[model samples]
Target chain A: GAGVSQSPSNKVTEKGKDVELRCDPISGHTALYWYRQRLGQGLEFLIYFQGNSAPDKSGLPSDRFSAERTGESVSTLTIQRTQQEDSAVYLCASSPRGGTGANSPLHFGNGTRLTVT
Target chain B: AQSVAQPEDQVNVAEGNPLTVKCTYSVSGNPYLFWYVQYPNRGLQFLLKYITGDNLVKGSYGFEAEFNKSQTSFHLKKPSALVSDSALYFCAVTSGNTPLVFGKGTRLSVIA
Candidate 1:
């Protein structure tokens, strides 16, 4: 319960449907991240939220992908009109904001395995 | 910009034998290297990290990684392999306040 937690550990949806994945980061952690891992591929950064500042959506592959973190607590990643290519394990990680001193590694959750059929 | 590379896609080692999983990095400044393992249908589990200090850093599950600045590598090592240790291993690197960049990952299969 102390580590990051993600909802809907496994999701199966029809293509072109919208889906939202939720992430509950560790309490007191200000930085939350989203990543996607396709079969046989590395984890790809999706979006990041650091405290109250604007989220960095540079890693988002397309406009259909977006995320929001409310008050440094919980975050949601939404994929609009998901395609088969969107099938992958969506991972969530959390860490303390800033450099690697007191805040070193990012703790990850079990992740949501999204399968778009 | 920072990047990590795991040259081998898979590693095979017999139980009780020493194991090495190679990892290389490309970063602008001092690299913050980390190793994580993933079991089937599971998230990445933290193994160990190299921030500064020592070149050889010990991590969880009897694993260690050697940070070689000159070679730009942070290869994971274990004195003795275990069958339970078989999993997908990833190497990650970060520079500045950027997000962690991960390698493709190497599947370690320890045979009994």
Candidate 2:
């Protein structure tokens, strides 16, 4: 209730399969972000949505990675033809607002561990 | 573009001793710096942030960070260390409307 929430904490899939990870941001939050974290690696930015509009999408590793948001409430990240390299923990975060980067601390979800075999 | 750097991959500090985790940033204009901690099997928890004014900002769990304007650095410090404090610490920065960009992370080990 006090933070962001993500569904299906652990997801395991075989290679070439498709998976959908969901993120339910904090109520009333307007900025949401999607990131991927490989084992022993830093967080890799995926996409950012501000009020259903994504201004920067260059972080997507490939065209296989896609994400969408609706009315600033929920966001879904879809990975198609997933490969073994896609195995990692996917994280989601939200803030009160976007654009200025000041006075806004991102609240994060526990993350969804995605394992592609 | 804004970026954060955590030079150390791992930091080892003895219990009861003070600890420091270094961070630096590069941004086009003013930089917003933050520190977050991740315990085992837990989501990243925000520790503190440096927005403006205060050079030293206190945060949860007795952690504090100093923002140095000239050095362009925001280093996290604690007067004393605890074993439970051992975790993965990340430094992040945000400028303009871009999403917060994180550093590679520094694994802090507070040995008891």
Candidate 3:
């Protein structure tokens, strides 16, 4: 609908396998973000795409985690060779502006619950 | 650099009683603070925000937050509690060009 949409509501993957999570941000939104939430924990910022600007990959845990956004449209987060520690809920959010607007609160998707075993 | 902290891991309140979830932040410049609630198996829902204007901001679901600059605090409050309010609440902050940093979240359980 109008809100951000994420695919594969739940995923179970064997260790050492690869998985790709998709996110469809709200139409016309300039900022798209990805975050990881561990069980009963807080959100860990993964990455964010603002328009055509180079995405901020500072929050990525390691080389195994990466993401891509196509012209502010759909985005994909790929975890290569996932490990048991990679299990968590991956959330996607979108906002009208990047990080400077007073009215740019993020709209989030239900998120993908990933299980690595 | 910007950061947020939710001191309490959980808060329990009786129905019809006032409730508060404490939050504190540290930012280099003016802080953009926000509150979000997460229900069971759901994504985070925006509650309210404090950007610049008023210190007290009203938001969805009969919730309000007070931004105290001097104290570096933005605490969420509600006059009366509802059992439906029992969920995980997260506090977040952003400053300048920094991405939003979230707190470890506080669970609010409103008993009936």
Candidate 4:
């Protein structure tokens, strides 16, 4: 089966510009998660969506970050007025189920490298 | 608050020697622990997980992790290291329905 896929492997944007990163989760995956990986820092959770219900936006760092998942499938993470601090690799992962107890491994996609100049 | 700690910034070992990367966690109740590996220019790859009923869990690429409830530790280990095993390793923990909290990754360098 195809793993999770994200588009625009690399994107360079000017500061204050908006950029949208897309993620296509595996077929039938009920859960999707977004994370940011900055150099010398661990992966930071961004947002999560499960089964089309209200997404968990708690991990979003700021109001400039927002994400939308449609029908438990494709998801888009947008950053408005991108900043140089936002430069990092945005990773998307999917799992078959929710809850922290589930052993279903998270399948990750090759992340989008967003560089804000 | 739930958290994870990877004390070692880097671990170097000779190929064919045993290797271990230490991780400790703090969380209320039980902990859902996982180990992931990342090669250059790649996304994290799940290596193994320890949920319950087992202290020693084996995972992909001949990697294994031992869960120690008393010490609040889940240390990744391998019997024999290979040069290809060199990469960044992460330890993560989640309690209940919360999202995974990752530790500062440990870079493993296996010298052949």
DockQ (C-alpha based) per candidate is 0.59, 0.67, 0.67, 0.69
lDDT of each: 0.90, 0.89, 0.92, 0.92
Which of candidates 2 and 3 is the stronger one according to lDDT?
3
Clashing pairs in 3: none
Stretches of candidate 4 above 4 Å error? A99-101
By summed lDDT, the worst window of 10 consecutive residues in model 4 chain B runs over B95-104
Clash count per candidate: 0, 0, 0, 0
Candidate 2 versus truth, CA RMSD in Å, comes to 1.4
Deviation (Å) of A94 in candidate 3 = 0.6
Error of 2 at B8 (Å): 1.0
> Candidate 3's residue-wise lDDT over A7-60, tens digit each?
999999999999999999999898999999999789999998898889989999
lDDT of 2 by residue, A52-80 (tens): 56446779999999988888899999999
Model 1 pairs whose backbones collide: none
- What TM-score would each prediction reach against the true structure? 0.96, 0.95, 0.97, 0.97
User: Listing candidates in order, what is each one's chain A TM-score?
Assistant: 0.94, 0.93, 0.95, 0.95
Q: TM-score for candidate 3, please give it.
A: 0.97
Residue-wise C-alpha lDDT for candidate 1, range A1-117, written one tens digit per residue: 588999999999999999999999999988888999999999999888888888888899999999989898999999999999999999999987673212468889999999999
Candidate 1 stretches greater than 4 Å from native: A99-103
| Model 2 TM-score on a 0 to 1 scale | 0.95
In angstroms, give how far residue A17 of model 1 lies from its true place: 1.0
Error of 1 at A76 (Å): 0.6
